[model samples]
Target: DAGVTQSPTHLIKTRGQQVTLRCSPISGHKSVSWYQQVLGQGPQFIFQYYEKEERGRGNFPDRFSARQFPNYSSELNVNALLLGDSALYLCASRATGTNEKLFFGSGTQLSVL
Candidate 1:
């Protein structure tokens, strides 16, 4: 009955470091998506995976990446971190349907200094 879960709640890093954020989707869900939310801005879609395959990617640079597991859980990886990369990383999951709404986790707050 869990909606979605994200791990490490928060992370702090220095420039040039790397960070991995994790997420587990709701039971029976097959689609997982990632988004980044910067202060004073809306969430920007980063990646979306369906059936363990890459479905969509956002305007982020190559430093951002993600993958979905066989169980529909997902991980978002950010390499060569920068201060600009600091934001709330959100994970969402939904069942297969065009009209389905995304169920989101609280998100991982990452800070780069």
Candidate 2:
């Protein structure tokens, strides 16, 4: 399925804009991946899933893991979380294989406090 792209393109725009628009993607995919992006750095690989099965694992420690449900929704768990674990957690899903196209989530901020 084709995901929704931003309007006004954010590439070209007029002076004043008063239009309220919503942009999102259609869910449900075969593979999913999790990432962690620290401040002033790129995203670091965390976990990977393919049809509720783990296909690949990143260089992260055993403290990180993920579980995929029947509905394709996934949960990422960090055992004995530490202060360094506080960062932006992102998720990406792919319709085809794990290494194919990937649609990334906006990510959520995780705090140790």
RMSD of each: 0.8, 11.1
**What TM-score would candidate 1 get against the native?**
0.97
Q: Pick the candidate with the highest TM-score.
A: 1
TM-scores of the models, in the given order?
Answer: 0.97, 0.72
Where in model 2 is the C-alpha error above 4 Å? 1-26, 97-99
Off by over 4 Å in 1: none
lDDT against the true structure, each candidate: 0.94, 0.63
Put down candidate 1 lDDT per residue, 1-113, tens digits, no spaces: 88899999999999999999999999999999999999999999999999999998999999998998898899999999999999999999988875779999999999999
TM-score of 2: 0.72
Instruction: Evaluate residue 81 in candidate 2 and report its C-alpha lDDT on the 0 to 100 scale.
Output: 60
lDDT, candidate 1, residue 46? 96
